[model samples]
Target: MTTHLPDAAPTNWVDRHAPSALRPWLKLGRFDRPTGIWLLMLPGWQGIALAAAMESRWPDPLLMAAFFVGAALMRAAGCAYNDIVDRDFDAKVARTAARPIPAGQISVRQAWVFVVACAMISLAILLTMGPVAIGLGVASLALVAAYPFMKRITWWPQAWLGLTFNWGALLGYAAVTGRVDWPAILLYAAGVFWTLGYDTIYAVQDLEDDALAGVKSSALRLGDAAPKAVLGFYVTAFVLALAAAWVGGLGPLFLPPAALFGVHLSRQAARLDVRDGVAALALFKSNSLAGLLLVIAMTAGMWDGPASAL
Candidate 1:
């Protein structure tokens, strides 16, 4: 009997529609929870949008599509790698005990092969980008390799994840312009705080399990102050994003959508309930919309001539 992951919806396509023989493989790659792909992909999209807007055009469709596919593959690979490293701890956690590795649906060797396959395909897509992007893509491997160990060493593993996941901001910008810029750096910083906020919310679901298993996370660190901490993280992210816009000379027309983006983040922070795992998961998933809102704001910023909002 295959076990549906606790965090995955019961009706997830992997469980409901994927061929039974392939379910374990798909689940190992986390195809059952696509929100992660969006979360990972959006930063790259935002970076592409910012670069294109600065060039006075919309984001390139080809680049956007490539990032989308790359994000999916890389996220899958990262998930499998995390599973391989965390298998023992996962078995000890209620929510994670059913994962492919821990549940014995997939062997560790097979999982490693899956990781390599996904990564090689992602590298093929990366190669289509410019040299700078290709270099950044290779550099990101160091971060990915280091991430699984972060929880064991720091209470702020989410901060590390922020750095790792948001590197796409730099990679995407370089992919378009063949170089990095201040706007890309600022956008990358914004993405970091954004991840810090959302991933902390995600960590809330594992508070008890993590504690019992002796791992550290921001949610465990913040305790009842999680909401306020998230609020701070989101606010910083919002301001940094706008700063990137201003620095990029995105026009005044960017304000409306940017304001909406900030408001959406604020609402998520306000509704956070660390004690309620279900609500926390919902709040975590909602970041996908928040990310899209920023993507729109950047595009709207380009709609007008490049000038700081006044």
Candidate 2:
């Protein structure tokens, strides 16, 4: 007997007011899932923490707040753009069939207007940054606009996502120091690997749907050995993040958080059941914890000051 689980009830006020057609668009961009925003925000925090280590102060709360808001707006914009581009493809995939445009809830023109409004809000936030940081923020638009197409042409679209999502690390450093540094680059690279790792796990949920629809992904590319690939990516992310902290001149307190993050990644990899979509999603969401742990570690390391302060 097939047991039918009820459609998930929408809980938020925005979700309720969302045009029935726009609902899928919002869901497609993961407005329902805040984890993507958290992932995007963490790299900005890392940059802030690294900058604080350089200045011998806690990271600026105002700057962090700006990043938080900017990330939310920009991530939403990116999602709308992606859905507009991928609407047909999304409709063919079971996992994405109900997306706003794919489900006939929102028109392409409407999605475009939504995207533009979100971009305007993001740009306003960007203006609050220094000229160099603002330029970096604006430059990121090129990457964002092109990302929805990368999956059509390349199996490594996740790499493109890494480049786009982690741009905040560079912007964070620039916002504080008004310049980029090796530590920020390393942190950004680490975030890229981190994104690749988690997003690949997320892709596992759509593997069959993707295969049927001719969609390419790291999960499909790695095939049965996806778990191993995830492990390698997570390991690289951890190593690069440690390099970023060291280059930033953080103190010993950073080690505990770093160690804890490593443990957490390993645990996720161990518990991951690639064949189960539910399990895959659960593991994927757990990455927010991984990102948070690193932020805490980096924050603590910056707070204590470098050895010179002692």
Largest TM-score belongs to which candidate? 1
> After superposing candidate 2, which stretches have Cα over 4 Å from the reference?
1-29, 303-310
In the predicted model 2, the residue pairs found to clash are 21-105, 21-106, 24-100, 25-100
Q: What is the C-alpha lDDT of each candidate?
A: 0.92, 0.82
Candidate 1 residue lDDT tens string, 137-190:
999999999999999999999999999999988999999999999999999999
Please estimate how well model 2 matches the true structure, expressed as its whole-model Cα lDDT: 0.82
lDDT of 2 by residue, 94-179 (tens): 66777678777778998888889988998998898899999999899899989999888989788889899999999999999999
Candidate 2: give its CA RMSD in angstroms: 3.1
Model 1 residue runs over 4 Å out of place are 1-5
